[model samples]
Target: MTDTTRPQDPDSRCGFVAIVGRPNVGKSTLMNHILGQKLSITSRKPQTTRHQVLGIKTIGPVQAVYVDTPGMHEEEPRAINRYMNKAATSALKGVDVVVFVLDQLAWTTADELVLEKLSSLKCPVILAINKVDKIEKRETLLPHLDMLSRKRDFAEMIPVSALRQTNLLPLEECVGRFLPQSVHFYPDDQITDRSERFMASEMVREKITRQLGAELPYSVAVEIEEFKHDGKTLHVSAVILVEREGQKKIIIGDKGDRLRSIGQDARIDMERMFDNKVMLRLWVKVKRGWADSERALKSLGMNDF
Candidate 1:
């Protein structure tokens, strides 16, 4: 279904676009790059994104609502993975365009699996060959694109460097053509479809993933208990829930050093994001087996799982 909320003036157009692919193809990075802001978190690790994040980008006559979805991969075959995959699949429904982002370094069976799904999509599909900066020669990139182009029918194929902000405007222009004329879906100044609390939790999670690394990143959740603004400063308090006492100890660190570092990093980013000083207090709590517990997962916004 086309989004008819945008103004119908000759110069007005708005629509939704879904960026889908296997994990770590720079979907979140592309969203942030297009919006010219950090609307979503980025991590080198796979499956860093767990939700369908909306990033708004307005250029001339078009406002593109870009949905950054979780990476699709085969896992334990449980409810969580099912939900995550469903979130990505749901994004394909009723959209103006679909950008199938791909990593240039390597193509795997899993990549084919994602493309196979895209081949069945009804909307126009654009193959965005991300990480073009990693490719040394332009000629070398053609073969990779050709291989995938032959596998499915893509509306348009374009190479882009989402991290380096290269060759993106053309892709944006290409996407804008698919948007229907309508009223603006959001204010021109709006940038994302996430709440401050949600963004704050995501920032904390990004820091945790960066410092603590993989094994512990997936086992943690951040809950914002207090967020208050007093004109002078933004005071925030959050709980980092872990699945075990050992995980809690690891997060808290020796004499709370680790937790302190994480808090400091998150606070700095939060301050920069909000354009004000932030007082952040972090505490670690244990909710053993929360990831596996359906009730607990639902409370943590993992209900899709």
Candidate 2:
């Protein structure tokens, strides 16, 4: 005879879930879709996510802390690349569930690297093949799904279009089932684990990603030196850090046109995010070879390495 017992009460379910994948796999987009807010930045550029951002979701009696990590990649051996890889790997520790996001259209060598890592995790994993909308037919997905499933022991395999908000609820339900029953870790009203300054910096960097081409996006980082709020207005000052003078020239653009455009877009988003009027000041600074410097990487909240 088989003994079966019901799981714990719904009121006790709470835990952390990490989303891991290669760049442009729609991890951040899916996290925002689930939380129904833009807590993390997203862009078309590869490696758009540079840090591990936590977005919280509360439904009925469960609170799931979802971490969106930087895209895993094999790049030049540098401090930043090491930091990114470290940050992505660190999310697996103590996680209740792992959501391995993949681009259904383009599953390349980098995706294979992420898949190899996911195969070794002991916890429950859900293979989320995102961007299904981009694919022409459903049958085309089978080979990739079969290939991945055979290579790993994922608890469930689900397809989703993070950009179109399709199949996300089903994916959430799958992840929810894996979380252990426990007391809520955060209040229901809270949506994210990052601070306003951190989010603002990310917003600025995202704007850079959208406005600038691919070559310059990954080399850029934004630092918020000051953020002050009065009743009616918020004042913000940020510095866009680049790795070299050529990148700085490109970021500032001809006669500051590019910088102004980036600042305008970022300011608009910040105002919407903060829900108040804002006075934003943006400056571009060149820090040659900073991406490879441990000291510089540590200063950017990437001290974990």
Candidate 3:
């Protein structure tokens, strides 16, 4: 006899929720916090996310598949930037709910771009004012909240701090209410749709971005050349692609100290995520004009959207 019990509750709720915003608005952080794990790469740098990362959360009868998309920026100086914008815009389509994340009391042309995109969305749009923890005056928020309501007829407006884990329960509840009635799309144990190899590359890229900060622009990308397992350890070899020899030198640092530091940080993260010891190898190579070339971008998995 085959014992396959029910996959989910008969009356469970499940749907896709796209999290959209401008660059550096904490969209990835919010999705990571909501899932209680880091499914998307995040850094202080703008445009840190260049693809649509799916983070799935299942609790009881509710499952929310959150799409953490690239930040929408108006400037498409290169083919990669245009690809990022396209990925973010595509996340809005066929979604059951949309969470428009915004920085606390700060609005820019980029935010306006996101707002303009949301103007025609059919799903429920929830305005989540993030970074409220940074706000000193609580009373000032009321006026800002009042002003935000005029922007659109948002389904719900919640003040939250994705970094501090504040008011997230309310936000989850609000999101849950909008999910349609359906069986879960993914297994409850599954946290993300991406493979371990993809996550390894993202970890390496994140470490580079965090370590170098503004020193390295969007000219860097990571590709996993090898992923294998032996005994109890997982071995990963990645190549860091840069646009110029000078950029390669910057990543390698003096006497390769910077590269070693980046490797260590990334290995630690991989260990935690994989729950196994990691043997990570990194190499920096100059891949000139890869970002500006659409074919190169597609080869690097940046055009999957």
Candidate 4:
């Protein structure tokens, strides 16, 4: 734990800024682009981020602690869905600024739900229209920006593409202007608040989510059973949980080929993240209907907050 209360630079500006949006809206991608590091896991699947991951960035004397939250959605049927909603909404409180990321042209009821949540908050909201790279017509933005302007009074609005690294400097500068004058809460070099074990586990899950078919990724979860560091190499043992026996087979593949691919890809990602050698071991286990069980979700640290 970093000493947040220690004596900080007097002229430093530090505050919490949250990234919130509907599922698969590129909120995680935006944070990673701004920080210049991949702290949050990214996949095409909705609700891939089930927890709040913090990334700290220092530019000159300003430190923006960006909290990448789970996508706030209306699907509350399962225990995991409800937990993700709670985790996402909870990030709104005590935040100095809110960066509401929205799809370039896809606005649905889920986006309305997020807008409603921001409507009542006291903090300033910076509306980020993400994925502008997909916009083929350059002249269409004027009217779209006009329509969004009438929706709500935003502190600042910018069209940015997180994946292509477009207009991120203006977005970061807009966020920095609203931060309260205070001392830096974290050291300049700290990129994220999460530990290696958690990131290693998420990296494995990201590969699984991206590699396997649609339904199986939603039913799967990764748990780091053990993580140890020997000065030279980091050892990680992860268990991949599934809802049934059939899903387990799919992840393991024929002759365990799929599992080996996931392990190889995850090991490479971890090695790059840790800047050292990583030995990763994976096992697929069946935790029948675990996603639907509240006790099971809590046991795996999904609802740890």
Candidate 5:
């Protein structure tokens, strides 16, 4: 009989790393770039992410399980907003390292709120100065970097452009140093903890968010009515929930053109993600005050975090 024993590497490292910051600060973009895939949904709108997304990257013997959290905001006027805040802060617990993302040289009251949470964490925190490509003068960043250093004793600070994929290797190296040595927690080939169904809903929601822009508020939510695979084609039916009839009409657009465009764009992404032909159907429904009701949020699966 042949022996089938697998030996563990002594140098292998694995741990959770939380990516956190104020809304629209490129936290999702940073993790997507680092993992070399789009595991988290992103938009220009603040608080685009409402749950905790895990993007796992395994390189050689080192595995970094990144928790891509919803951006922390100062306001929690609605139940959904409070849920997002809970999701973001929960990612910090038991994390081996924390990557605090900041936009360029700007700091606001929202960033101050995130800083207050970091003050109590015992783990290492690394400051990632994102959108550095927007800075016209390189010399101007030194003074800003010095000012940031005074705010907290970060484990490491590196300037990076998440969109341009610049200087990210150094950032990854810095995060890897703080991870503890242990056996790999997940398979190397697996990229995310989210299921295909969850990703499908996110793809649909991303299209809606991008299409509506400022015309629509955060009251929009997507629920997958049907997800079935037949032959070589994947069929998906998603219902878009809104707080008011006017919001539904806006999403439907004149002659349903906007809804068609959103569905077409979302199908393209679903095809690429699943590597199969996708047939998508969308419907708009009015669900008033869903954002403010905790019961409604739980029914929509928004309270899972």
Candidate 6:
């Protein structure tokens, strides 16, 4: 939204590009790689990205405001899942270009759900075949790519390895071609639309997701209590909310070891991103089944926080 209201660069090329896909299709990874920074948190877990993370990449004459949306899929309409779905689908509207990212060879009903949503879009949609590095046989992708291409008349069809930094230039250039000529919306140095505090909360949540058991991630959310910098060192205090006390125990670990690891890992990332020493204090508090309650979700700052 910040990028949308900025002054236009009359002659420069700038446009909003929404990156949409099913879970674990590397939407966040692609955004981070393209921006050359980790603005969106990523993990092996599906639906790791809960918000619409915007990363702005201003390269010379082309400034691409990349909207990295949460994975689109069918859900039970739980409060949290509905929130994530809303974030993803809402991002698709009012964008100049749409990047429909898909796994290299794996297509599923979830991907079809995302495609169904794109049916009404008025912008040019680019089909990006992600995770191509996993495909050892390049020839196998030809038939699949052709099949995908026939599904819709995509503005461009590309195969890329988001994690390995492969074949992104052509993708960016091709996207830039669809963008209307306009003035730069953001400063050349600004890479993302989110604040440092927001990224910090996501980093903390990411560590918990990466280190915890498979079932724990869906039951967790991060709340940033305090984020401040006293010139030399940045101090951040955050709360890790879990759905149940047992889940809280898992996050805290034996003798609080798991909690310590989450804090340590998050601190390291905070230091790297903030370019300053970080003192991160994390507390685990049980807010039972908050993900399923719309009231709890609202209180947890799920909307525009």
Q: What TM value does model 3 have?
A: 0.97
lDDT per model vs. reference: 0.85, 0.86, 0.93, 0.90, 0.92, 0.89
Candidate with top lDDT is: 3
lDDT of 2 by residue, 1-305 (tens): 22122245545688899999988889999999999999879988877887888898988767789999989997747888888888898888889999999888576899888887776677898989898998998888988788877767789999999999999999999988888888777776788878999989998988889888565746788889999998889999999999888898898989999999999999999999999898999998988877889898888777742
Cα lDDT tens digits, model 6, 1-305, are 23342445455788899999998999999999898888999999999999998999987778899999999989755889999999899998799999999998988999999999999988999999999999999999999988898888888889999999899989998898899888777877788878898899999999988987485758798888899989899999999998888898899999999899999999999999999999999999988779999889888777853
List TM-scores for all candidates, in order.
0.93, 0.93, 0.97, 0.96, 0.97, 0.95
4 or 6, which is superior by TM-score? 4
For model 5, what is the C-alpha lDDT against the true structure?
Answer: 0.92
Candidate 1: C-alpha RMSD to true structure equals: 2.9
Candidate 1 ranges with C-alpha deviation above 4 Å: 1-8, 215-217
Q: Would you list the clashing residue pairs of candidate 5? A: none
lDDT winner, 2 or 5: 5
- Between 4 and 6, whose lDDT is larger? 4
**lDDT per residue as tens, model 1, 1-305:** 34444454787988889999999899999989888888788889888888889898877667898999998886745556666788888888888899889887578887887887777667788888899888878788878777877888888999999999998998899999888777778777677868898899999998998888855747778999999898889999999998889999898899999999999999999999998899999999998877677687688887542
Clash number for each model = 7, 1, 0, 0, 0, 5
For model 4, residues 1-305, the per-residue Cα lDDT tens digits are: 45453346565788999999999999999999999989999999888898999999988778899999999998788888898999999998899999999999766999999999888898899999999999999788878888888889999889999999999999999999999888787877788878888999899999998887485747789999989998999989999999889898899999999999999999999999998899889999988889899999988888756
| Models, CA RMSD each | 2.9, 5.1, 1.9, 1.9, 2.5, 2.5
User: Which residue ranges in model 3 land beyond 4 Å of their true spot?
Assistant: 1-10
Candidate 4: regions farther than 4 A off:
1-10, 213-217
What is the C-alpha local distance difference test score of candidate 2? 0.86
- For model 3 the local lDDT of residue 34 reads 93
Residue 92 lDDT, candidate 2, scale 0-100 = 85
